[model samples]
Target: MPTHSVLIRDQALVTRLLQQYLHLLKTYPIITKSVTSAVLSALGNLLSQVLESKKKRKDGQSGKEVDVYGPLRFAVYGLVITGPLSHHFYHLLELLFPASAPFSLLKRLLLERLIFAPAFLLLFFAVMNTLEGKTHSDLQDKLKARYWPALKMNWKVWTPFQFININYVPVQYRVLFANLIALFWNAYLTSVRK
Candidate 1:
């Protein structure tokens, strides 16, 4: 009986804490989103490192050790770039194509894929290369090698995801939802980056 009471108290405490956190996130979207993105991107990079290590081991080679700096790089990029950019992009997208009707969702999806996805993917690749100290020629070459394939893959994954996101998720919760999915997306991006 005492244990049951303790469990109940703990559950209630957790619920209250979660509520407070959500309230804070809503009140300060940019800061919260940046922190969330930084954490998730770091985690994603770590996951990628783990997977790569495992693959190397399975291939009968010494596993490559995970480098702390790689994930740190992703965390910084997420904090400074992706978090704020994605938050504002979603807000503007919603304003331009308010999902008031059924087809409006499709419209937003089309606009996002047709316009935003290509442009953002290009910029993301370019910025990542530049930050990694790639010269202009190297950046252009990397983009040529990776951009279209990554964009194609992005369309494959994000098209349906955005359909649900734009139509179903509330405005305030949209970025949070996307950030949750982005854990896996970022992991994939890290692998692709290599």
Candidate 2:
């Protein structure tokens, strides 16, 4: 029942949208990751705030500060650090261990889980502590207190996710996929660190 001109106009709109997306994918891959990371990080922090508020309320505490700074720090970290590092690391991972051969998925998964995850956890705590304006000893103490528990929790969540990520996701979409997963993961991370 749609007229010819209306159909053409709809098709043209879709084409334009696709073209813009492809252009971003081709030309601004890292920037796209930064934006995605920032948005998801903010979402995660929002969840963290809500969960913390609920916990406080349950404990008979009131007037908990809804710290906007936490989300802002998350956004900055995502924009400046995690986004670009993940974008490049996944590329290098694919380059070093192309996913075309037998057991490639297993190999990538193991390498990522074993090597990158632990290192990244340490870096994340260090960076977050620094962002909080904690001194070196304070940062070290925080790490000592929280690191292993967080790592254990990270493994609990990320193990299966990375299996799907390294095996099934295309290279171009891998960071976006990870960011999508990270919204929840970051919420978990934020809450755990508290």
Clash totals for all models, in order? 0, 0
Per-residue lDDT of 31 in model 1: 86
Candidate 2 lDDT: 0.86
List, residue by residue over 1-194, the lDDT tens digit for candidate 2.
99999999999999998788668977999997887788888888888788888998999999478889988988988888888988998998888888776788888998899899999888888888889898999878878898999999888889999899877888888887888888888888888778
Candidate number of the best TM-score: 1
Query: Candidate 2: TM-score?
Result: 0.86
Candidate 1 clashes between residue pairs 3 or more apart in a chain or in different chains:
none
Candidate 1 global CA lDDT score: 0.84
TM-score of each: 0.90, 0.86
lDDT of 1 at 163: 81
